[model samples]
Target: MKQICVFILVLMLTSCEYFNVKKTSSEAILNEELQTFNWNDVDVYPTFSVCDSNETKNEKTACFTQVLTTHILGYLQNKSIVVTHDVTDTISLKFQVSETGMLSLLNIEADSLIIKEIPHVKELIYCSLDSLPKVFPAIKRGQQVKTEFELPIIIHAN
Candidate 1:
């Protein structure tokens, strides 16, 4: 009788899910009902620059800074606000872009970690988007053609 009573108690304490198996797939969640970038229409263009000076006194360097800044901050202003877990106005990142216009993710170079005393609080970090290399167009009959654009963003949460 004691054994039967223990079994009954256990059964009563167990929730309906305790004995059931779940059948959800990660792929289904990855492709969650959302639209993604239209990679097919993306363009890549190179900015011309003089290799000697840190300051861009030439046309190419100026153009590079302009485009790079737009791509980097544009996403942050639109996306960072909705990062949900992000409490700060900006998300910091550590990244490197190859000389050939390929963007690489380095790390989240941040000094301050999240504080638990305040809920949803975040900190700002630095990213090298400002120094991203310019991709020059290919020369065809003394002309150039635009090709592609690539940028990577990194974030860390505590």
Candidate 2:
């Protein structure tokens, strides 16, 4: 019977593995998602009360940077730093903002010449960061997350 043969062929094709929908386990799905997720990128950057919260990502970043730079420069400028030699170097300052909005200095990288010229530079930077205003932690997936920043501070002293 032609109808019976057609039904048999259809049944055979449906029974093949290629036609079956595979079900993935939740754990496997989660693993895949984690693999594809970008850990370095955050949905929202950390902000200060002075920064506009509704700004775009780039604007938020700029606001944060400007605020931080202003505060640090202001603090440093208040102190009279006298250097014997004309020194021009960049200091790398690595710091972190905790999930609870606490700022902590991780490390400071400065050239030997700069360090020799300004022996108390590290202490000044530490004190400056300690006096920073309240910071808001970065947001990732609507959750507060800790973030690290490395800012280069150029020192030009004659």
lDDT of 1: 0.44
Q: Spell out the clash pairs found in candidate 2.
A: none
Cα RMSD to the true fold for all candidates: 22.4, 2.6
Least well predicted 10-residue stretch by lDDT in candidate 1: 117-126
| Candidate 1: stretches off by over 4 Å | 1-57, 80-95, 111-134, 137-158
Query: Could you tell me which residue pairs clash in candidate 1?
Result: 43-148, 44-147, 44-148, 46-135, 46-136
- Candidate 2 stretches with Cα past 4 Å from truth are 1-21
Question: How high is the CA lDDT of each candidate model?
Answer: 0.44, 0.90
For residue 130, give model 2's deviation from the true position in Å.
Answer: 1.9
Candidate 1 to truth, TM: 0.29
Residue-level lDDT tens digits of model 2 in 58-80: 88888988898888878988999
